[model samples]
Structure formats: structure tokens, C-alpha cells
Target: MVPNVVQKGEVIAIDGEWWNSDPIKVEAEAKLSGGAPNVSDAFTINGQPGGSYNCSKSGTTNFSVEQGKNYLLRIVNAAVNNHLFFKVASHNLTVVAVDASYTKPYTTDILVLSSGQTADVLLTANQAEAKYYMTASVYTTQGFYDKTNTTAILNYVGSNSSATPIGLNIPEFNDTATLVKPCEAWLRRSIQWTYGHSSSLLLQHIRCLYHRLSFTSPVEFNYTGDVPNTLWAPICGTKVKVIEYNATVQVVFQGTNIFQSDNHPMHIHGYDFYIVGEGFGNYNESDHNPFNLVYPPLRNTVGVPVNGWVAIRFKADSPEFSCSIQKFYKFVKFDDVATTLDVSKGVLAERVPVGRDIGG
Candidate 1:
């Protein structure tokens, strides 16, 4: 979590549905074991609801910047259960960092950020002296209770204008293909984990001994929390995923489940993972060949493509006992984890079984 001590712009973070969508509620036994997606609902920005009957744009603010100056715009996805699409009017963002790690200065008009992820971009106020709408909306896979466009305006200094800021074009709602097929090749990793001259041995060790884990959602929609024995409950737990220190780890988040297919922005706590590959349907060894060891995007939080899977690799360099507790369940497990983890660890049960059944 980035500290508030740093300078940050005024932008509303839409976490989850406001009414009853809490982190604890999403991991409830009913949702985990019973296959209920009782995540968050409509939320208010800075305590202000949306416009046009709580579904349209709301809680708009203004950030005044001088003309002809470049500013570093740091965007964060604080949503607990959703990935957001962000854009500004007539501006091409030069992305430099993601999840606090640097990238290859990729430029784009719109960027997709999942929950808990951060993108640092350089925005140049080269446009005319006017206000432009900087909008944030849900980039969803499940066509559910999506929110209206959440916006803030980029106002120019020395301009005494109360006119409405011009809004830019956001991606079409429910456009997974557009979201998945990124226009630019951001999958290349700009950073490499080499320990000086021992890089070859380090890579060898990482390739030989590695831990593979899989995470998925429930299969059937029920409320009794009595899922069949074939599935794994999305409950919170500690002391889970204990591994030896310095072990190489490869994790695959499978999205093709029997219950429902959705996009999940998986976040890691200690280190960033090199996003090796992402594709549709189940993951097969022969099918997923020529892994992007050359250059892949490394991030602490990466997403599982809707109804698909994503593969990531990283060294377990940071070792510590981390805890994963259900936000509402009062149950705190003291896991002796070699690699401390975030929320996704709990939802991940053993490796994906044969045939890639999320539950069985």
C-alpha cells in the first residue's frame, strides 16, 4: 500500500458495491463454498454518490495543473473486487512504473488496472487551457451491476472557467477481447533478476526447483456453503503456501471454472512476478510453449484473463511468516509461510487437478 505521505492527486477510488460489498463478504462461506458472488455494490466517491440516480457519474473533483508542464500521474486500483479502465481526454499516458516497478515507457490512451495495482504515468498538459475529464470505470468480465463512469477533471491553472470538462472515450462495456489483446506489447519484462556473475546458476536453480500453485473460484451457485467434495472453498487461512526460502515459484491462475468465469487481479505481497503468459481456456504444457523468458511484464498484481488463465514466475527471495484472515470471520491463522502472500493465496488450493477442474 502506498503511503499517503507522498504527493497524490485527488481521484476517487471505487472499491466495491457500497451497499454490502465488503472484502469479508466476498470471501464468505456462502460465496466461497456456495458459489455466491456477493462482492461489493455501488460505492460513493469521497462520500459522494454517483450522478443520475446513483448509477451515472458522481463525486467529480478538479486537479489544476499548469499548461505546458509534464506531471507524473500515479493511479491506483483500490477496488476490492474489480479492475478499472482509466483515461484522460486527448492525452497519451507514458507509463513508467507499474506496481512500483519500472516498465519500458509504454504509451497509451487507456490503461487497464486491476485491484491493488498501481500505474505511474507521465501526463503532459499540452492541450489548450481547458478542463478534461479523467474518467474511471469498471473493466468487468461478468456482466453484473456495473457502475456509471466515475470522473475527475484535469483543470488548467490561470483559467477562470466553470465549463464542464470534456470526457474521453472509454472502452465499450463488457469488451473482454479488447481488454485482453493489449495494443502494445507490455508483456516484456524490463527488469531481470540476476545476482551478478552467478546469474546462470540462479536461473538454473529457479528453473529446476519451483513451486506451482493454482487459484480459482467456486463452481456452483448456492447459499448453503455446502459445496460438493469436488471443489475448494474460497476461505481465508494462514500458514498456507509454506515454501523453502529462495525457491523459484510459478503460479497459474485458472479462470475457466464450472461455476462462473470472471477476471481476477491477483496481487502478491512481497515480490513482483514476471507475467510469462496469458490465454483462454485451460493451461496445457505443450500448448503454452516458448515462454516469454526474454521479456515479460513484472508486477506484484496481475490478472487472470476472463474465462482463461495467466502464468507468472518469480523467485521466493523474501521469506517471512505471513497471515491471511477472513475479513469478517474473526479467524486468524498464523501460517509459517516461507513466502508471505496477499489475499489470493487463500483462494488458491493445491495445484490445478487433472482436466483443470476448479473444484474437483
Candidate 2:
């Protein structure tokens, strides 16, 4: 169990969902097709499609709140294959925690969460005494998605429950900037940890490691730009990168346009790495743009922006075998390989199972 770093008022749990019609039948077909999975019938909140959905009004999830009180909204995106943009009408959310790690309170009007990511946000019931719609919609650059959004109700104490809740405006289905803007604030670690290294050490050591990994790329074209038809077929195999214990490891994940330009959320088990830097387009190692080594946000999963890249750093201290893989795949096939961290004294150690064996 995780403990809150700051005051967590009344806690309210919320989660994103994907309503399916005959999930078993379609899942079987999706695996065989080697293509994008079938789009979900509806986006839901806590299993209910909400009032906006046809025949779901009576089952809408509603929460009663008193004015001047604070409620902590713990939201998790559990959709099978989609990122989400969530918001409450007329209320700004103060993001205090993410992926079970507390972050310095950063207020934003919108929240973007990729699958398997969790955010703890504080919502002050300071708005007018009325019913407000809490909604979640798709945040993707992909062509296919569940167009219908999910909704719930934030009913202030004594507000008319029968009243039609005021709805909130969500971003356009494919709005990439809105999705990235919320993350620009760069959530900082609320508490300091001693694992961070000096910038000079990072450049000298991590740069050499990155140089070795960069060459592993089959052929570098315009990574974030158009890809030739010949490059659509991905190279698949098992590869392991051995690192020394307590060594700082930095990885740059580049999102390519091989099949379709889209965001990829990468996750590494058994490690909460610092998200040092990220930007659109291919990452340049010598750009000299500084990484936030001082108080970077630590997360186990990070979303690589559509046609972009992200750099993460972590201390490879855990002796256990760990794997890193993309959390969601739409355009890509089931060709992802598990990159393991076998931290031993220049020798491969015995592998132990701790996370998902996604690479088969």
C-alpha cells in the first residue's frame, strides 16, 4: 500500500473503462488479424457508460459533495488500448500524485492518462452549488477509437439531482497539443531522493550507454517523419542490456511513423525511473538541453508522444531481472521484445519472474 505525501482529503476513486460487445469473440479475431484491435463500443467510468450513453442514465455514478470541502480523485486509466483525457466542468484539478508516487501539486484544467497510469488529483468543491459532469474522452492520434465519451456526476450537497448536469468540453478526438500541454508543467517530485546524480556524471556515463543502444537501431531514417513501406515490418528478437548494479541508466524511446503515427506508453517493471526530458521529433543526444536531474518526476511508465521521443533515467540497483515493453499497441504488431536488466558483476544472473512476460 502507498501512503500519501500530503493531505489527502476525502478520497474518491475513479477509473476509465472500455465497454465491449462480445469481447471474447473480437479478441480472438484481433489476435489472428495482426492489425488494430476492434474499437470499443463505449468509453465508461466505473463500468457505467453514464447518462450521456443511451439507456445508461439510471446507472450513472454520482458523488455528493459539500461546498468548501476537498476531495481527492484517484483516477486510473484501465481501458484495454487507449489513453484518456479527463476533466470536470468548471473545476481545475491539482495533480498531487501519479503512478503511486506523490508529485508537487501542479494545477491543470485537463488530465491525460495513458493505460496503466494512475493519478491522484485534489478537487475543491468551490464551484457553484450545482451538478457538474465529470467526463473522460479519448486522447489519441490513431484513426480508430471509441468516439463516445463516458461521464459521471459531481453533485454538490443539496443540488437538484434531477437537474441535467452541466457538461464539459473535451479536446478534439485527435488533439495532440492539448494532450502534451498538460504534461508541460513537468510534475516534480514532492520529496527529494538521493539517487539523482550530477549533470556532468549523467552526460559522461549515460551518454556512452545511449551511444551503444542507438547503434542497435536497424537504420535511422526520419524517425518521426514518414517511413518507407519497406520499414513497416518490425524486426523481432530477444535482446538484453547488462548493466552494473547502482549504475545510472538512461533510455531514449523514439516513437516512429512506420505504420501509423501514435503515442506509445513504455513501462519498465521493478523500477520507478525519473522522466528527465521529452519533446516532439527525434531526440538529439548532443542538443545540450538540460535534463531535470534535480527533481524530475519518477514513474514506472511514460508516454512517448506521437512522432516524438522521451528520455528516462533510473538507478539499476535491483538485482532481479526486469523487462520493459510498450503498454499499449494499436498500429504496431505483437513484435515487442523484452529488454532486461541483468545487474551482476559483468555476468548474466539467474532470471526471476516479477513482471509480465509480454515477449513470447
By TM-score, the best candidate is 2
Give RMSD to native, each candidate.
11.0, 6.4
Q: Which lDDT tens digits does candidate 2 get at residues 1-360?
A: 134533425555455555356777676677788766688888788888898766888999887888878778888888877888999999999888899998756889999898888998888888889999998898877667788888989889888867889888889988877887777787322212111111100001133242243324436666655566887665555555566667777777766666556677777777888887776666666432566767788787788777566778877777756545444564233634345555555557667535755643
Candidate 1 residue-wise lDDT, 206-303, digit = tens: 12145444433223222122324355334344234455556676665554343444565554554667887765554445534656777577787776
Candidate 2 Cα outliers beyond 4 Å, as residue runs: 1-9, 18-20, 187-218, 330-337, 350-353
In model 2, how many backbone clashes occur?
A: 0
Task: Point to the candidate with the largest lDDT.
Answer: 2
In candidate 1, stretches whose alpha carbon ends up further than 4 angstroms from where it belongs are 1-59, 181-184, 188-243, 320-360
lDDT of each: 0.54, 0.70
Q: Quick one: how many clashes does candidate 1 have? A: 14
Q: Give all TM-scores, in the order shown.
A: 0.66, 0.86
TM-score of 2: 0.86
Model 2: which ten-residue window has the lowest total lDDT?
Answer: 196-205
